[model samples]
Target: MLGLNKTDSKFLLIVILLTLFTPFLMQPFAADSGLDQFNGGYPDLMQKVAIFGIFAVGFNILFGLTGYLSFGHAAFLGMGSYAAVWMFKLLTMNVIPAILLSMIVSGLLAVIIGYISLRRSGIYFSILTLAFAQMCYKMAYSVLTPITNGETGLQLSLSDPRILDGATESTSLPVTNIFGLAMNSSYKLEALNRVFTFNVGFYFCAVIAIIAFYIAIRLFRSPFGMMLRAVKSNQTRMNYMGLNTKPYTLAAFVISGMYAGLAGGLLAAMDPLAGADRMLWTASGEVVIMTILGGAGTLMGPVLGAGVIKYLENIFSKINESVLHSWFHWLPDGLEEVVVWVFARFTGEGWHLTLGLTFMLVVTFLPGGLVEGIKRLKKLTKRGGKPKDKLDAPDPEHTPTPSKHVV
Candidate 1:
């Protein structure tokens, strides 16, 4: 519909619908009800879902298409965040310039890292990227204190020179905006005694994510994408065919890095802060988890994974014994205590344990991630009680009677 094939068009439409209706999707627990604690429709969490979705989508281009597992892509994200915050500090409070600078700076950094890391493949390549990322984190935390502000993070100040705009006249820190529209601006919709928040920041990130997804779809169907898949399947074969595969792989790595950077920029744009912790290896690993858990090679898998993980982090982490008890209060006293104890391990401070278990299940049962699982379920349902393959269907022409079998 929008210069896309039927599949791409449909995918885009689904994304648009989901993004628009995310408030209802994430907050099915009912407002001010006993399950209200499970609601995740707030602006901050919604912004996160969009931002991380971009990050995971970008990572999929490399890890999914090229089969290049990078442990350092988070460096680009951190770099983008730092660049964005600097833009906010030096330029106007507008987010456009900051976002632009972040992409450029992160892309440049990715090119450098990719060039060096692409020399080796397999574990060697992974280690090289990991080293680079860790070095960046260490430098930012120690030697780059002037730029990164060390442990305190980079924040907007009233004294800084903003050439595009005059000094900040307000007493407090300036809020990021696009011209007259504040990033934090939101509209509340009340329906049937429930409140739903529609935030400008979430929509801004959603628009960018949709664009990114569309681009990804185009890339997946392009000749270049075929080359990346070829590179993933048999790089040796490509090399033997006299194809310079290194350049192709390097290009994918750089592109993926730029995607990560763009995500980082969006995060800073939403929150207007940059910290060394953002570049940590754990953060990079989280994107890896998101991509793998969602279905690394598929278009919608990464986005789904990001949303799931973010929800778990934000919602499950809030559960306490009191909340657990409330839900199990209907059961017998002894049984309720046991059930709450068991459930408590998966929520609140132990949310990571639940995430780990889910990751393990996905990996063990659906190596292709949640997408493959969904596909399997669909296939099973389509088959009904019949066998899965066409081989089970009788063919009169192919089947010989016992009397004519010998002949």
Candidate 2:
């Protein structure tokens, strides 16, 4: 069972199945259907979902388990991207070396940042991390321009020497690959008027995401995870008990950073570009929102949150005024125009409004996030009707005592 109990084993199995069938699941709409715009089976969007899913999963390990919220994780993510791109520029176009160097670079940076930031707790810690991320972002734009390529961003160039790859006769920049297989290579299967694209890049990211999820599951079940939960419950109490929680917290931070690094590296592997904007505070905040919206502490919450947010960003944002007008064309002119205007505010460029509303509703009603909502739905289905009154319901813990002996 891969060191997991029955429940966890089943959960892991479900995750694996979902990852494997993502192409089919995401392309539920027919290619020529009205809902085709909602289809996310394309390579680029699918790769993003898997990549950011890894990012959120990693962030959950630190914030969800240890209660240490960081606002600078994007710094590690950006660092990883830069490291990966440099590897591509100087070493080779192969993704393995780039991914490895990315994790190492980001992990090292996390050590220093965590050491300083973990010295404080709560808001102070958050502010410290945010400052560090902004500093990194600024450095990438100005001071580290030589490395990050400033505003132009670091990208593959034909003039650069790829030592491991040797000399190339082609004038064009090389694409990222594994061995000889190109990352962007894909196969499209047409059936039932639907096109399911099976992309090499998406599969690569999906496999990595599955491994990351498995690792997160193991970490959640381990004794160290318990220690982290204890820290979350009360680090001050653990301190009073003579336990040094710093090392544990620092380790969790570094591990989380490494996960982000892997995510960033994968992004580079898929696109072969690194931009300073990846280190922006907004990018860091996006992961935080993803983690919180999906149920922070739960195993599947982060991934679900990432998928939902990314879906909204990709699909909902594409719904323009023209699309809205088409959908409402059956209505009278005035009514259709009004409806389009109302809907336009929430879709297209204003998709963030929809996301904000969704986040607010989930937080206000289901504080545990989407996972809690799903759990409640499952419970409701099991009940089959309204829940029984507390007085009418038999208590499983308290059974009636036999009084026949006394009689």
Model number with the top TM-score: 2
lDDT of 2 at 149: 96
Count of clashes, each model: 0, 0
Candidate 1 residue pairs in clash (backbone atoms < 3 Å): none
Regions more than 4 Å wrong, model 2 = 387-407
lDDT of each: 0.91, 0.95
What ranges in model 1 sit over 4 Å off?
Answer: 385-407
lDDT, candidate 2, 1-407, per-residue tens: 99999999999999999999999999888877798999998998889999999999999999999999999999999999999999999999999999999999999999999999999989999999999999999999999898899999999989889999999999888999999789999998889899889999999999999999999999999999999999999987999999999999999999999999999999999999999999999999999999999999999999999999999999999999999988989999999989999999999999999999999999999999999999877776777755455446877678786568764
Where is model 2 poorest over a 10-residue stretch in terms of lDDT? 383-392
> RMSD for each model, in Å, please?
2.6, 2.7
Pairs of residues at least 3 apart in sequence or in different chains that clash in candidate 2? none
- TM-scores of all models? 0.94, 0.96
Cα displacement (Å) at residue 331, model 1:
3.2
Residue 18, model 2, lDDT: 96
